[model samples]
Target: MNKMYKVLATASILALAAMPVAANAQQLPAQAVQKGNANKQTDVKNVPATWGQITNFVHDKSDKFITVTGRGLAPTDQDEIVLAITPKTKFIDAKGKTVPLQKIIDGHKTVKAFYSPNITKSIPARGTALTLVVQDQSFSAIDGKVTEVRDGRILVKGTDVYDKHDEEIWLHFADKATIIDQNRKTIAAGDIKEGMSVRAFYGPAVAMSLPPQSGTNYVIVNTNMEDVNPGEVNELTAGTAGVITDQKDGQITVIGQPLEKGGVNYVVLSIDDKTQIVDEDGNKLTKDALKTSGHVEATYGAVMTLMYPAHTHADKIVVKKAESVKIEGTVMPSDRTSKDQVYVNVGSDDSTANDVILNISKETTIIPALGGDTALRAGTKIVAFHSPVMTKSLPGITSAEVVIVTSDKDAVQPK
Candidate 1:
C-alpha cells in the first residue's frame, strides 16, 4: 500500500513567553507574605479571583513551603498568579468533602484559586493562597470507541492520547455509579451499547491490570441504536470522514466519503444543542464555523435515520483539515541549523523534483506508521500529509501533519 499524509496543523501563530525560574509555594516571598497579612493591607471583602485548568502542581513535603503555578483565579482568566498552601489552607472535592492538599497538587486539575493581591514583592513573586476550590479531581477523560459493552463492563479502543498509539481499555461500573449524557440526564447501565461513541472520565480508582480496568461512571454518548428496531436503521461509526454540505438552524447535511458500492452521497445529521463540534486538533468550534469547504471526520451511531439522505445524530464532529495534501518519495537528511527539523524528497517514479525541506519544531506532529522518525532512511518509500503553504525561510519549505511509511515499492495508500 502507498503512504498517506494528513496534516493536522494550520498556519502557526503561537506567542512566546518569558523563561521561568522555580520558587517555593509554601514560603512565598516576603512581599507576598506581607501583603497577605491583614495588618499589611490584605482585604478579604475584595479578594482577587483566579480560575482555569491547573496545568502544573508542586507539593513540597521537605521545605513545607509548597510553591507551584497558579490557575486563572481573577474575574478574567489569569494563569500568572502564584499560590502557596499551608496547614491552614483547605482542599475540597466535587462533593465538598475535604480532600488532602497532597491530592490537589497534580497536573491538569481544574481549579479556582484565590490569592492575596497587592503584594509588595518583586516581578512575578509567589502569592499566598487565601482559598482554593477544586472543581474536579485529578481525573483524565478517555474518548474512544466502545468495542464491547455488558451489564457491568465496557471495552473501548483509542489512541493512547499521550503517546499517540492505538490502545484499548475496559471499564466496570459500580451498582451506584453516576453516569450522565450530554444533557445531564442520567443514563441506565443497559443504555450503553457496543460500537457507540463514549467520552469516559476515569480515575479516582482502577484495577492494577495490564491495560487496567475501572468504573463506567460518567460518560458522553453520541448515539444510541436501541432507539430503533433492527432493519429499520442504517449504521455509522467513528472516524468516518465527511464534509459539511449544509447547515441551518441546527440541522446539518454531510457528504460522507463513499463506503459501499453505489453508496449514498449525502447524510442528514441531526444536531441538538448538546452536540459537540471541534476542529481536527480537538479544539471546540461553533456550528456556524463549519464551512462547506472544510472537511470533517465524525463519531455517530450505527442506527442511521431513514431519511432521504440517511440521518444520524453526531456525538462528536472533528473538522477534517483543508490544508492537508499528499507527498511521496524518499526521506532526506536535514542539513539546516535548527533544533527540531526534517527534510523529505517529494519526487516520484515519474519525475524526480527538487527536495522539499521541512522545518520541524516541537509543535510539528510526526505520526509514524511503523518505526520512529529516526528510522526514516534514503530510498525509503515515504508518504506524508503536509501543509501546502510553504514557510518563508529555510530548513523546511513545507511542514508535515501526518507521515506514513510505505513498504517495498508500494506508493498506493494502504488501507
Candidate 2:
C-alpha cells in the first residue's frame, strides 16, 4: 500500500512541475523556495524542485518514521503528495520563524515543507524533507502612548494586548519599517512625542527583561493628543476590541470586554474629520462606513463629557471583521449578486434565524477539518472558527476562519 501511494504521489508532483504556470508556487513563503541538489542520492534529475502544505504528519507508534501528506504541489487540483519526516527535517513558519515539531503534530494547522532538491532516490516518490513550514499569517499589535523616542527606536507604555497586563515595551524599527499616520501617509518618526497615542505591529521576537524589548515591522503614530492625563492616560492608550453597538452623527458605541473587567464594557467614540479610520484589510473607510460597520478595534483619549455613559475622541479606529464564533449547521449560501458581502445560512434547517452575512477578507483561511478543499454549496455542513466580537443584528454579521465544508464538491478553493 505504501509503495502504491508513493507512486501516485510522485506522479502528482511531476505533473505539477510539467505545468505551464508552475512559477507561481515560488510565492508560498519568503525563503521557502531555495535551490541545490547537493548530492547524487538526493536529485530527481539535475533540475531542482519545491513542494508544500503537508497536512498529515504522523509518527509510528514506536517513534521510528513519520509520514506527511500535503496538497497543491503548485496550487493545483491534480497535486497531492506525501513526504517522510526524519530527524533532519527543520520546522518553521512562513516568516522563517522556528516552530516546534510537536505543535505541528498536535494542531490541525497546515504544514508546508520544502525539499532542497536532493531528497529523492533516483525517482521523486519521496525523501527526507529539508525544512517544514507551518501556518502563520496573523500579526500582533501594541497600542499605547509614546513614552520616549530616540536613536531610531520608539518606547511605548501601555497594556499588553496579548496578556492585557499593564506593561511597557521598547520597539526597534525594522530596516524597511513604515512610519505612517492613520491615513497611512508617510511621516517622520521623530515627530512622535511622549503623550501621543500610537500603535505598532511587531513580530514574535522579544527580549526578556523588566519591560520586554522588541522590534516593530510598522508603526502608526497618533497625533491626536498633545498630552494625556496620567490618571486617564491608561484608559486613553489601552486598546479595545469590540462590536459596534450604535453609530450615528459621528459617534460610535462599541461594547467590548475591558482589560480589567470580564463582562462587556461600552465606549462611545467621538469621530472627527481627521480621525484615522480603516477596515480590517487596512483599506481606508469613509465616515459613513466607519459608523455602520459594527465590529471595530479602537484607541481613544479620556471622556470629554460627564454623561451617564460618557464619551471620548476616538483617535484611531479600525472597523474590523468580527472574530471568535464557531458557526455550525447546513449552509444556505446566497449568490454573489454584487461584490459587497455574502450571507450564508448556518441556521437551523434552512431558516435565517442563525444565518449571518460575512465580509470575507483576502487574508481569511478556509480549510477542511480533515484537510484538502471541501466544496461549499447550499445546505453544506460546515464548522467555522473566528474571533473577539460579533454583531447584534437580527441574524448578525461576521467573518470566517477554517470553514470545514463537508461536501466534496471542488478540489480547489480560495486560499
Candidate 3:
C-alpha cells in the first residue's frame, strides 16, 4: 500500500506538471459557477495553477493531514486537479516539525485542475471590526494591520486570517473597496492608524507561485554591541533595534544603531576569539560574533580588523588622528620591529602621544604607511590617547598638545 501511495503521488505530480495551457483556456469562462450550480466545471483542465479555498472539515488527530475530495463541474484530466491546504497555526508536519500557517498556505495544492477560490495568491488585510465575505466563507471582524499596500496589493500583519488563531493574511489591494475607519471616515493608507477597521474585495483567488519543494535555512546574526571587533562575538540584547544583514550556514550579517557624523569608532574584540553570547533564554554560547550598532557588553578575542589585525605580513592599516588630539614634532629616524604595532615619536610635552605602542585592538592593526618608513619620523607630530584600544584606537588626549616639523634656527625665518 505504501508503494502504491508513492506511485500515486508521483503520478499526480507528473500530471499537474504536464498540464497544457490549452486546458486552462477552456475553463476560464465558467469562473462564475454558483456555489451549488449543478453544471459547475469539475474538470481539472479548467483550473489555474493557483487557487484558494477554506477547509470544509477541521481535522483533530495525530496525523493532521486533511483528506480533501471535491466534486468539480467537469471531469478534470487525471493530474490536472490540484489541492492546496492551509491549516491553523497549531498544525504540525508528519515529522513533528513546526509548520507556520503561512508555509501551509504557500504549499497548498489542488486535487483537480479547476481552481479553488479559497486558495488565492492575494491575502487580505486583517481587521476585527469589519466583515470579510469571500467565496462562501464569511469571517466577521478580525484584528489585523496593513503592513503593505500598493496598487491592488496588500498584506496584513496580525493573527487569525486563516483557520490558525494567530495566522496573518496576505491579500491583494482593491481600490474600489470601502474602508470605514473607527472614526467612520473613508481614508487612504496615509490615514491608517492603530485599531482601524478594514474589509477587502476579490476577483479570482491567487496562490503563491513557487516550486513544490522547500528551501534551506539561512543564518542571521543580530546583536546590540556596536563599534565591535570585526570578528569578535558580542552580546546584544533582543530588541527591534537589532537586525540580521548577512546569512550563511553558521553566520549572518546584522546591523544596529544609526551612524552619527564626526563621531568616534571603537573596537570591542577580534575574530577567532570566543566570547559569551546568550540566547533569549539567557543560555550562553561560545562563538565568533560581530555588531554594527547599539551597546553590547562582551569579552571577545582580537582577530583581523577592518585593517590589519596586527603588524603581520598583511596590508598596512591607516590610522587617522582625532581633532581633539594635537600633533607637533620634528622628523627623526628610529627603528622598531613588530608586525602589528607602529612606533611614533612624540615630544615630551605632547600628552596624547606619550604612549609608544597604540593598541587598536585585534580588529585593527597598525602597519607602515604607503612609501613611509617603519618608525615615525622625528618631525612627525602625533596626538594620541587611550580609548577602546581593542578595535578602534582613536586617540584621546588628557591635555591638548601639538607636534610639527622643525628646522634649525639658522634655517627658519623669525616670526
Tens digit of per-residue lDDT, candidate 2, span 1-415 = 0001111232232232122211123333333323565443422322222332333444666332234432223322112233555577677877778888777666644555555332311111234456666755322345688888877777788754433466577777665555767555678777777788886655344444445555564566768666646776545464456656557887886655443311114467788987888987888987777643256777765433322133678777887665356566655545532253445666446476777765655534343322223345444566555453568985676665435455534323346
- The RMSD (Cα, Å) of candidate 3 is 27.2
Off by over 4 Å in 2: 1-27, 30-142, 150-153, 159-175, 201-217, 225-376, 380-415
Q: How many backbone clashes does candidate 3 have?
A: 73
After superposition on all C-alphas, the RMSD of every candidate to the true structure, in Å, is: 22.1, 19.1, 27.2
In the range 1-415, model 3's lDDT, one tens digit per residue, is 0001011232343232222211222223222445677877654323332122332222345222222221222322111122323332133333434445444445442212233332211011010111101122211112345555444334444443233354233443232333334333444544443333343322122232221211101101111212445453323111111222223443322222212211012221322323235543455544432332212322222222222111111011111222222233332333442443444445644554443444333332112221122233334444332233233233221221111113322222225
- Give residue 100's error in model 3 in angstroms: 34
User: Cα deviation of 113 in candidate 3 (Å)?
Assistant: 32
Worst lDDT 10-window in candidate 1: 13-22
Q: How well does each candidate superpose onto the true structure, as a TM-score? A: 0.28, 0.30, 0.17
Clashes of each: 23, 7, 73
- Give the TM-score comparing model 2 with the true structure, all chains together: 0.30
Tens-place lDDT digits, model 1, residues 209-287: 5455554444556565234456544343433455554577677765544343123334567777677888777798888
lDDT for predicted candidate 2 compared with the true structure: 0.52
Cα lDDT, model 3, residue 64: 27
Instruction: Please tell me which predicted candidate would have the highest TM-score against the true structure.
Output: 2
